[model samples]
Target: MYQKENSSWVKHADFTICDMLCLQLAFILAYWIKNGVGHPYETELYRNVAVVMIFIQLVCTFFNESFSGVLRRNMLEELKKTFEQCTLVCLLVLVYMFLMRVGSDYSRMILLVSYVFYIGFSYCSRQMLKKFLKNRRYEEGEKRSMLIVTVSSNAKNIVETIRKNNYGTYHLAGIVLMDCDKKGKTIEGIPVVAGSEDIISYIHKNWVDEVFFAVPKEITIPEQIIKDCSTMGVVIHMQLATMKSLGKNQIVEEVAGYTVLSSSIRIVTPRQMFIKRTMDIVGGLVGCLFTGIVALFLVPAIKIKSPGPAFFSQVRVGKNGRPFKIYKFRSMYMDAEERKKELMKQNNVKDGMMFKMDDDPRIIKGVGHFIRKTSLDEFPQFWNILKGDMSLVGTRPPTVDEWEKYELHHRKRLAIRPGLTGMWQVSGRSDITDFEEVVELDTKYISEWCLKLDVEILFKTVMVVFMGSGAK
Candidate 1:
């Protein structure tokens, strides 16, 4: 039996003080820079104005509800609110001076300059502090550990979400099944500790930080479970049906009598979206720069051999099975798809929903052989990545015909947006012939996903592409 450790109130108080101190430092610096050394200090009038300004700013921030919950604030939204509050405070101070006929006493230049510097610096400092705390917790192995109480399907989804998101502070300790024949079994390597009856004893004995009730909303005794955990000082989280019902573009709202979690159907968290887009912009830019050099060299060679357009476009299935155009440099003849029918009998590759032809006749005389070996044909996909149609690392997009033949499990690949290069590309691309194996690799990638994995795959892809051993 492991008992969870709780941080003392003094520790929280200290951190809060640190937060306020940092904010105050920003204010002091802004004041000093905006007002020269000649400005009066410690005088009755100066002290009164300083006290009033600070009090009003804090009050306005409170009224804005900026500090409602440490966990509830969206990072970007918080920044915006902070800027707005700071701006309002500066404006109010200006109004006070005008009404009192003391406008000459306070420099307008000082007010404007300090307002900009203090607000921007304070907001940035707060964000940096948050990142520092998150990194420290991760490094200390002190993530918000949770015991999920649910069956495999529900537990699997929660586990995958936590594992995939680096910024999510949750670290799932294990799961507990409520009702099932495999009550004692584990789901995806997480142990199933005990049933409902043993939850209190188990939590008290173990160091459980949070208890996530992933059981469906239909379960009646969830409140009792929440109460039991509450007594033990463990935080409780639950999966609500309202979250599952929302569409991709729907707005989340909390009404007077109702609280619901609405989300996008794309299955991405805000942190995930931020990291993915950041990677796309950075990676896409680097890829485009390199591709430009390659194009300069390859374009001429490709033209000398085939005398056709240096690029190719094809329709592919995107997120949610939407149709989008995918791009590649021309690795085959202009009429490759049309000639595909003629090469069917000669197709050496076999038994895949997607097409893969070895020694393809549709390949151009010289460029096709080199393009497949070096994987240079796929370079143009950076444009697609930039356009938000694909990612630097994700499941390869499928053809329309191939996507149509997918089963429910196969469709899970589409749960994420497709990528230009992924686990399949680096995991012996040409050697892996079994479709099931490919799907398994893709599924595994999705389950154990992380930014680290994406980075590793990208690194390995470079090696694979250079070696040119696996591509047909």
Candidate 2:
């Protein structure tokens, strides 16, 4: 997985901290220059005014996106935006002061001084930072070194295109040729450093920042190379072959100056992604607390009945077929895996890709039945959510064995992190016996996914749990 660099949440947080600190510092400096240090807060009204001004300024900057641009390319524009934001903040403060009948209590001179001080200081500081970044990128050689992975003919076009774009962030490093015989060849002055077979090893040994797979449509990029890049945390961008039809909301992104159609399933903004993760963290905490309380009542009963561990941990395929151990309260006997092979003949699911039985003999007697009915068995997975291995809502993670049987298209369910509860769970998990139907529901969830849909699914899950539907 390519970890998003300079993520929006991080940028916003940085700008917010900088703006707040600068605003408060500007006001303090102005106050000290005007009234001297002895008269910090002359009146209780002054303190109230200061608080209100800070609040209003933060609100204005947030809404105006005053601090949302890249500093190097946006110095003049950002300065103007900052001035407008500060002016708006002052106007709002004046209106608020009038409404509170404290307009006379605060100094107009201080406001005028602070406004000028803030604009000048903020602009100068931003320009200094911009200069520092520019120096670091160009003078200090901080630009990311990119490797283009393709044949000689395609590599020439990609190299030309990238040079034409003049993207300053990434510098051309070399190329990886698909044809083994062209290992020592050069495409548009960039040497072919390695063949396809040695690409992964070469990347591991070198300081390559990102790799662009621009192979022809007929050539298949090996899955191992992608997995290797993901594991090593080296960013990978694959060129999308021209297609007649693409999904709604599909994005075309410029990666290392090459225009590639982004095939992301997440149709969410950066703010939305931040909010979703925050929700997952909060929900996971609450769910874990509930799980702890419930465990007090259920653990002993489960142990007494099964005479083994209260929780079961199994290796499950997670996002992008990455494996992680999934935790659940042990609802089956210790011999469950042993019994599974014998029970394969009795598998009810049409495809045998998944196993589900109405009266599974492997389930521990009373405790298993009770927990399964009420969904208490799923509580331990909140830990997984907290660990970032799972989410509060997504497709169910499949077992390693089950995943091995998956068709290429079936693996699309792993595009997002698996969830504790999802469309499949709420939509009669037990009643739907066919594995294909499960895949269909999972696919539908991915295609139409949003925060609103997650909330709706959560509500439906609550209802389903209350009704004890499909708990068999």
For lDDT, the strongest prediction is 2
When summed lDDT is taken over every stretch of 10 residues in candidate 2, the lowest stretch is 131-140
Please report the TM-score between candidate 1 and the true structure: 0.50
For every candidate, C-alpha RMSD to the true structure in Å: 15.5, 14.1
Query: What's model 1's lDDT at 383?
Result: 87
Q: Give stretches of model 1 more than 4 Å off.
A: 1-268, 346-350
lDDT of 1 by residue, 1-472 (tens): 2344333333234334444454455556656776645444455555565666766666554333344344335688768756866777778877777887777876666566667766776576667766665554463266677888876567777777666543556676777777654556677777888777777788889878888777776665556778878887888776655543454335546878777554542343455567767899888988889889999988888888888888789999987798899988898878888887776666543454666767777888777888878899999999889888999988998898789888887887776779978898799787776677778888778766766688889899988888887887
Question: Candidate 1: lDDT of 406?
Answer: 85
Which run of 10 residues does model 1 get worst, by summed lDDT?
Answer: 6-15
lDDT of all predictions: 0.72, 0.82
Candidate 2's C-alpha runs over 4 A off are 1-242, 254-259
